[model samples]
Target: MSDDQDQEQDQDRPAAPGPGELSPEMKRSNVRFALTLPLFFMIMFPLCYITALHLPVPHDLPVAVVGAGAAAFIASAAPALAGKFTLVPVDTPQQATDMIFQQTVKAAYVTAPPGQSAHMLVAGADGRVMTQLVPTVFAPFAAQAGNTVQTVDVAPLAPGDGNGIGLMFFMLIVCIVGFMTANILGNAAYFLPMRTRVAISAGVAVLTPIVLFLFMGAWLQILQGTVGQIVAVIALGAVTSFTVGLATTALVAFLGKWALFPGMLVFVFLNIPSSNSAYPAEIVPPFFGWLSEWHLGAGFVDAVRAVLYLDGAGLGGHLLVIGLWFLAAVLLVGAAAWRKRAAAAGEADAGDEDGEGDEAGPAGAAASGAGPERVLLGRVHDHHGTPLPGAVVTLVDHRGTQTGRTSTTDEGGFRIDDLPTGAYTLIEAAPGHEPAARATVVDHHGGGGHGGRVGDIRLVAHEEEHRHRAAVATDGTVPPSAGSYGGS
Candidate 1:
């Protein structure tokens, strides 16, 4: 048979198995990823929640004793309440009230004037559990004096909010929605510029808080702060959303598909247990109490509580911590973008050097009496048809052995030369994008200087690819070139 006829026959034959063919290595990788996710959730959920919340005992919970001889009274009662209450002596009831408003003390006990029952002042805005616990701890002293205690709630929760934790639940919803929004943008909008993604996140941050504030504060009437105080809480919510979203985006940029593990670890696992929303920090375990001092959620909860109930006590410190988080996340995202741009520039430069010899066509080599080089080349593009620089192109033969690997140039072009004629799979992959594969025949006898050119290979962003796969699964329709090959 003539060489032309043989080449045509080779081209006509099927180059690889049908779509959805997975190599052994790919199967193992999929299984490992699947198992790792459930295990991660199992360990993190129980470890953080159960450990922090199992048994809550107050550690040096601050309380004030008011009126004359209060110091002597506390000193006499110290042994009974050792390690549980940190009692301070105040000269009068007014001073104790001032201390409570400033959040210097959680609650206060006032000694009765000659015959009246003693007063126990508590802030119901500080979780109800803490409010209830305070009076119980001071009940013995009141009983010894042959007087009962009259509990007064200085800062009470809104009548609509029975549990006083509505804001905490609202903050959690805002945070989780912000986090998921950023994650979705990272995967689905991978082709957008970094600044655009950041802007989108900022928009979400602003909008989420305002909408939730209207629902939880205006519509539900669960929040009982003044207009300015409510605005302050809304501002804090915006900061929380922006900070968490940007932090999650940075993680996604650096870790790709594995970003969720650390993102959830920081924002959900650690943040929730230490937030002091359900229990006061002093009542929880020491580790979580320490975390409450600086953790992101803790800062939000503290600042909101201060604004709504404590007359903005300790507000500056909590805002400072949250601001620091926003700053750190901004820096991390900038670094990720810079790193990606630098790596792409380096790969483009390398691709240029590798392409130098390819300018001489295969015809030139054939004329020189040397055998034609078996080179395979192509350009990669995103779903929008823009060049995708730094995309990885890997070649694997029918035996599942990787034959060559190269990254795309600034123009999204790549070349792999000196291959033995065979049927092979070309795999294209890039960060935050779904990998794609197609089969092609590389026959030296095809009469061209290059063995083959697979045309432009387009890759879809992860979200789009996922949707496509879901559609395919539902209809039992096979997508073209959905096969995976082994890698070295």
Candidate 2:
């Protein structure tokens, strides 16, 4: 049979192996992927949530007691309370008030002169969960002096936000949005260029806080902070969420679909429970307490509490933690992209050596049964250096008449055999990737088929339009002006 007849016969048949012809390695991989989903979702996910919210008790909470006489009485009568509280005794009520604003104390009790009622001051903005715990633990001590105990709220919750638990809800919302953004961006990485993807994700992350701040401060009147402080805290949160999303997407792109489990385990399972919103780290298990010191979720809550209620005290450490998270995520994603490029370069080098040995001389090529007709050969790759299989390649002559057509193989390679010796426009098109056209001349006498080889054709993606629309929805314009706040 002629070469044309043989080529036609091969094109009519299946190119890849059917399911029954699967290799043992492929079968094991499929089974492992199936099992991983159930293990992470069904077992680990619920277990983490239940363990964190079930039971919580104050372990080493901080509170201030005014007056030396009251401090001595508490040391003698409530020794347990002294151990649970990092107690700070001050001479006057003003000093105790300073401690609450500094976040050195969660609540404070002022001792009455003698035979009078005691006064308790608590910061309700420290989240309702812990705010309630502080009074519940100290109510007994307040009753020792007199029957009447005056409970005063130093920092109260927003009028609209009935309880301070709304802080926890906002934290959860930030995390969910972050992970969802990462999932969408990660899928886009397969088609879009790396720099474009990074710019889109990071830009959106930086802008998200502005809109959230406007809603929380200007519109909702929930956050009791100056415009600058509110913007700072919310920006930190949005950047932290952006980093988490970027890191998760990078892991999945580099390591495959199974890599999602590790991201979920760290960012969701561990982060949410240890955030110190639902359960204070001081009152929870040591494992979660350790995570609270560094996790992004905890950082957002801590910074928000410090800015809104604690007079901006102890916010530096929380902001540092969030900055570190963003820096580390950027490094990880960059490393993955670098590694992928290096691997593709290595493979291309090996292919070049083989192609060089095959192309000798046209006279010698004819002796070895190579025809006079020149052939075109090339490979298609995405922006990330990933092979794109089943991509269509069409050849058109100078007049735009269709000359030949072929599809990329399972290895992302294609060769159109027995082509006429002439100039043609080679168009490489693939799903998700941008279609590219290049002009090339094919001649059998040119370098004995060595110079005719098209090394690698890279394709861009059509993801920018989708990303732009989404960004507009989240951050279309600047937020409204914030209102002034008064301290109690």
Candidate 3:
């Protein structure tokens, strides 16, 4: 209670953070993780879910029709249905039933006898949404014929699998785990070699499904599938999801943090809603329905459902979708790794040049007094990283001042000498290649230590570069902003 006690407490208290004390890295981390990620999830999660589920109406849904008049009735009423049903005429009800079992059609419409109710053979195993939708779609036709429509679930959902959505939820969980696991591995173990990361991904892919199968299948009994069946579906789903994450992470490695946009757009936005897990593809929009045919989540869900209830008739197609995604991801990650290695080698070469210059006696060079020149050195490479010769290189200082202009020699090397020390923008332009801009910093401690290295400038081929290049043909007017690939 006394002044002495207060003084002792003040001494024990922690110091406040000083002004500008937060490192740039810390600020960026908070902005990306604490602020951005939470906001993104909060906004996108609800938006994606609500938008995907809201007002789902059938569009171009294929159905098999039996009997002489059924196909004609569907064709006549198709306009009123907003092109919702694509009716395929079958010779007999058995043919329609076979098509439904093969998943060639979502449902089968059997024409009723005169003065009798019409029967619609639906597959509850396709999805609760689809099963429910069939009746709604056919009710009008049945009404026009003065007959009530009866929906008979030809392929039924498993026990405890309420409305057949259990499998969808299971697929969603597997996808989330698979991608999130890959992301965690990519970030936490980023310092490790790519091959090691890939191996780790494979191991995680194997282990995660095993755990999921035990929990969701054996322990929970929510998924109605045999042990082997569950294991296969889980494995395929995990591997596919992990590959998605790996590809996103590799993009970050190659294109830097900004690549997260496309990655999330593809995997989360475009992939999930279109996955046909939340709603049947037939009920959702045409775009989503199309995506459901090949998207990883949809493929997994289809495979799981087929194996569990449809006797695995069309499982291979879904499995093929998963495999293709995995292959594309592997290729993307491989390309990123190659670029990383090339960039590192370029840096090493630049560092070696600086070392050699340093060894050439700074005192003697200082005596030469060549107008305090800040030398800019770098090399140009094509998309595959082959050195590009005859490339034009230009430099502009931070103050919008243009300076050193040169061209690459046979080895894709260029140098600009005799410039005041400051920040600069380096631009590489070559015919048939996209121009690239790199920011450089030139700091000279008086003496021949006036070395400013721009390392490597990779110019993607015109056809391959996704970004639009600025006009580098002008008087060293650097237009494209310096981003993740800043050279120096």
- Which candidate number would show the highest lDDT if scored against the true structure? 1
Clash counts per candidate, in order, are 1, 0, 0
Worst 10 residues of 1 by lDDT: 470-479
* C-alpha lDDT of residue 15 in model 3: 31
Please write out the lDDT profile of model 1 over residues 1-488, one tens digit for every residue: 65456446545644433454543433565587689999999999889988877877899889999887577668778888899889998888878888887777989998875456889999887778878888887888777766578999988887878877776787787788778888777755543545777789889898987888788878888876778887878788888998999998888777655677888888888877788776888898888889989988988988888888777778899899899999999899887767655544443343344334332222222222112225565567764556678999999999999999999877667878767655688888888777777675553221111124444565666654221110000001111233433222
The global Cα lDDT (0 to 1) of model 2 is 0.62
| CA-RMSD of model 3 | 17.2
Selected candidate, larger lDDT, 1 vs 3:
1
- In angstroms, the error of model 3 at 131 is 1.0
TM-score, prediction 3: 0.65
Residue 63 error, candidate 2, Å? 1.7
Model 1 misplaced regions, further than 4 Å: 1-27, 113-115, 356-488
lDDT of each: 0.70, 0.62, 0.63
Supply candidate 3's per-residue lDDT for 141: 76
Question: lDDT for model 1, on a 0 to 1 scale?
Answer: 0.70
Query: Quick one: how many clashes does candidate 3 have?
Result: 0
Name the candidate, 1 or 2, with the larger lDDT value.
1
Supply the global lDDT for candidate 3: 0.63
